[model samples]
Target: MELSLDAKDTAFRDEVREFFSTGVPDSWRDRVRAGLRLSPDELTGYQQRLAARGWGAPTWPVEYGGTGWTPTQLCVFWSEAARADAPHQFHQGLELIGPIIFSYGSPEQKDYYLPRIIQAQDWWCQGYSEPGAGSDLASLRARADRDGDDYVLNGQKTWTSYAHVASQVFLLARTSHEARRQQGISLILAPMDTPGFRINPIATMDEKYHTNELFMDNARVPVANRVGDEGRGWEYGKVLLDRERMVAAANVIFLGQIVRGITDAARRRKIRGRALADDPGFAAKLAQFTVELTTLQAMVLRLLDDMTRGADSGPRGSMVKLRWSQLYQAGTALWVEALGPEAAQFAALDGATLPADMPAALQGALYARVTSIYGGSSEIQHNIIARRALGL
Candidate 1:
């Protein structure tokens, strides 16, 4: 499919580009470029700026503070943001839990959470994966027992991204064991400060505190905290998961990273007085990767077109996620190879001194290792394609 942006879409893209160039705080941009993590205040400030512009919640309905932009506009907005090195708007709140609350949450829940989320008053984290339940999410053992008006929750959540920085967590808890493994699950919203909640950081190869292990011991949350009916969380979770998968499939952000990787690799001298880009073998590989990247980007735009035209239940989302993850991993591998040993030895440098092109490309390659893992693993995406698209 040939991907072309209309005049209106191009205008919208320019608007978004201008906004990021001028609207996003310089400090945040510098931090992202330098490969340093944003402080909590800096992160919240950036999100609040988006929220102020009514660009905070991209995919939500307008009633819930969504920009109500067309899918193409959303695509452009994401591309511009990534290119400008803007702070990542954590999706756990806006992308994942906010939708769940708006869809299945009670009116009280909506009134209580949605506005704050849009205002950046609260940061949210996902409490889904547990120690043996990463991919087999239905096997999660986090339990919540109803008592009076409260549910006492007890269990652990591993790889909970940004939990330490969040004020609340949207969790999945097993309320019954008699029904199908997936059937008895319930979604709960618990304050991070609730008694018996502990967050321990998980160190990754990048030396960043991006993930955490959350332990909930007798955490008491009100029944009012329950989203949707009990034992139907599995169904609700599927809705949220579908949204997550669709967003993940949008390869715009990763595409920008790949572009940067190629540019950086080309500029740096490799061996024999030649840059990596001058090497025919490297050039061929870059050309091939770009072709695939372009194709995947087109697929992404097509998916957005379908969504803009009000098509739901499209399998292209899964296909995009699957292809993008594979292509990204491959592209990053090529990028690191081009960097030679420097890719491995580059310490996680502070954002201030980082060369513009190299840090993000290098760190992004490292972070892409989890792209296939989180938001549903590559294996799961394949299963979805086979079952939904291939009919195998």
Candidate 2:
């Protein structure tokens, strides 16, 4: 596929660049470029700025405050944002829940949630995975039983990212015992502040508290909070999961980080004043990284093209996920090899405390290890490709 930007796209790209350059706060941009994490307020503030420009939900319909751009334009937006080191603002609300609600939610639900989602009024988190049900989500045991007008939810959700900071969570709960495992599920919206709800922090390998374990004991949510028909959570969840995997695979920021890592490694030496980039073996590794990146980018563009043609990528989404995850992990491993022992000493630096020269690349490499584990894991993705795509 031709990756060149056309004249019109070039103009659009310039406009987007100017807006991001001027509209986003310099402090936040600096922090992002330095490999630091943004505070919740900083992240929300950036989203609000994009929301004001009607660019908050890039993939939604125009009626829902989306830009309504073409797939290519969307790709350009993401690439330019990463190039500028802008903080990611579209994942939780715009990418995940916004689509789910707009696709499956009632008009009242749309009216109630879409505005807050666009305006960044409510931070959202996923409530899908549990301790026993990470990749085997159909085996989830989180139960939600109807009691009059409300569903009493009782179960624990593990690896709920940003749960402590989120105002709401979209959850999948077991609503029936008679139906098959995948058939008895329902999607429910649970407020984080509800009684009997508890969020316990889980310290990650990177020393961050971004993920948590959520406990619910008879937490009550209105029946209206259900996203779609009862006993159809698995079907609806497949839609959300497909979309999630696609977006997660299209994370161009990781590509940028990989590029930066290669560049930094090239500038540094391994033994006795030999630049790592000068070594033929290390140069070959960098070349291999570039090739993998190119392949992943092309695959992503093809998937986006399929989406543009209204063709379901289906299990091909897992192909993208698997390729990107493998490439990302390989690139990071190469970076660690280039850095040698320095990889161990560099702690993951927050956006506020990043140094100008290659801060936290090692930490990022460590975090990338989990990239294959989370979001259905690479093994699970491969199984999906085999079963759904290859007729295995």
TM-score of candidate 2 on Cα atoms, chains taken together:
0.90
Model 1 clash count equals 1
TM-score winner among the candidates? 2
* Residue-by-residue lDDT tens digits, candidate 1, 122-230: 9999899999898888999999999999999999999988888899999999998956788889999989999999999999965567899999999899998999999
Report residue 262 deviation for candidate 1 (angstroms). 2.7
* Quality of model 1 by C-alpha lDDT: 0.77
Candidate 2 lDDT, 153-180, residue by residue in tens: 9999999989989999999999998556
The TM-score values for the models, in the order shown, are 0.90, 0.90
